[model samples]
Target: MPDQPFSLDQLRIVLIGTSHPGNIGAVARAMKNMGLADLALVAPRCEVQTSESISRASGADALLVGSSLHESLDDAVADATLVVGASARSRTLPWPMISPRQLGAALPAELSRPEARVALVFGREDAGLTNAELQRCHRHVHIPTNTEFSSLNLAAAVQVLSYECRLAWLDAGDTAPARQTAMAKGTAPAGEAPFGEAPFGVEWDNPPASHADLERYFAHLERVLVAIGFHDPERPRQLMARLRRLYLRARPDSLEISILRGILTAIEKHTGRR
Candidate 1:
């Protein structure tokens, strides 16, 4: 049987701390051009519906009007099963990084799961995503550009990624069944196919944990770690960050998260903190 074509609707474009109304409009235009409709604005500095934005959006004002507003990045992507942050530079701690094309190739299999939502997050125009913000993503997507002139406009960056996603969607519609079969059988032709990659290639019995679920687990884990005197809140090392990276890379499912939480509860009971 043929696999179902990946739906653009399963993907959402999240703009964090966007300062310019015009850029927001242009982003809407770019999304519409690529057949993507979901737009999330997190702590936007400018109004979503403005004359400048409408003018820049050209004919894509519907997207701007329908866009969801979020108070924080976490709120915006709380329900997303997969979150990929767009970053131009590397951080002190390395993250699982992939190129825009690789990201495009990976989306088909990712969106195949039931109720799975993927968020493509773009940061501010001036500074880009903060270290804390990037840490929330499961993967970081970097667009390879010339070292001498690597600066990219906000809307232009969105356009580039949006184009890649549309290309992937079209390709999946045509060859998903064969490609998926080959991947399941570990016979996919190598070279830029992103086949047999961690997280993407693995089959799951339970749905991948949502961003909200992971956040709650992290909070619970932190409390338990503190209760057990295993982690210090002040004058401490990067213990939490490292653990976060570990679990994010693992991409634990809902059932796994539940089990982990249960363990934390048992630890609290044993520690006499409950």
Candidate 2:
């Protein structure tokens, strides 16, 4: 059969340190154009409810009015299962950066998970994201622009990424024709399945884990490691960072996260760290 329709509601567009109210409005308009409505603002320099924002938003003013504002990026992305930061600069330390197409392909599976939340983080127009801010993201997305002059306006970047996300959502839902064709060909026995094995099997014991859940796991893990003398918190040297990279790359679902947490708990009890 065909896949379920992608819900744009699962995706959140987050702006950090947005300087201009007009850009916020424009971003809202761009998101609405691509069937994305959820928006979150972090430490905005200007008021989102200003007349300028409403006027620039045109008919998409609802997005601006209903949008959420936060004091920090951490607060904004607290509940998100996946966080993707958009930037144009190269950092001293390499990050897992993916192109827009790769983001599109991976997002569909992520958003399909139970209670999944994804955040597309955008930074200021003039400076983009700071190194510290970029480090918080699981993946970084860069919109390839002209090398000679690759400065993209905040709204323009939002438009490009939003369009790509919409295309990916549509692609995920457009599997009916292929399924029909496969059935007609009789590729296998009559009762054979076509979609292949499901991730982590058919029965899931827990709802898909959120970003907050993973963070809690990491915090618990750090405590246990400290107690077990595995990680020295004072002079730590990228141990947690590397662990974050490994787990984030895997993008474990709810069941997998539970299993991992159970393993951690067992270790904690074994070492008398609990």
On lDDT, the candidate that comes out on top is 1
Please provide TM-scores, in order, for all candidate models, with all chains considered together: 0.91, 0.83
Identify the runs in model 1 with alpha carbons over 4 angstroms from their true place: 1-4, 177-203
Off by over 4 Å in 2: 1-4, 180-208
TM-score of 1: 0.91
Each model's lDDT: 0.89, 0.81
lDDT of 2 by residue, 120-195 (tens): 9999877899976787788999999999999998989999999999888887678635644665775523442111
What tens digits encode model 1's per-residue C-alpha lDDT throughout 144-208?
A: 98989998999999999999998888887778677677878888776442222344345556788
Residue pairs clashing in model 2 are none
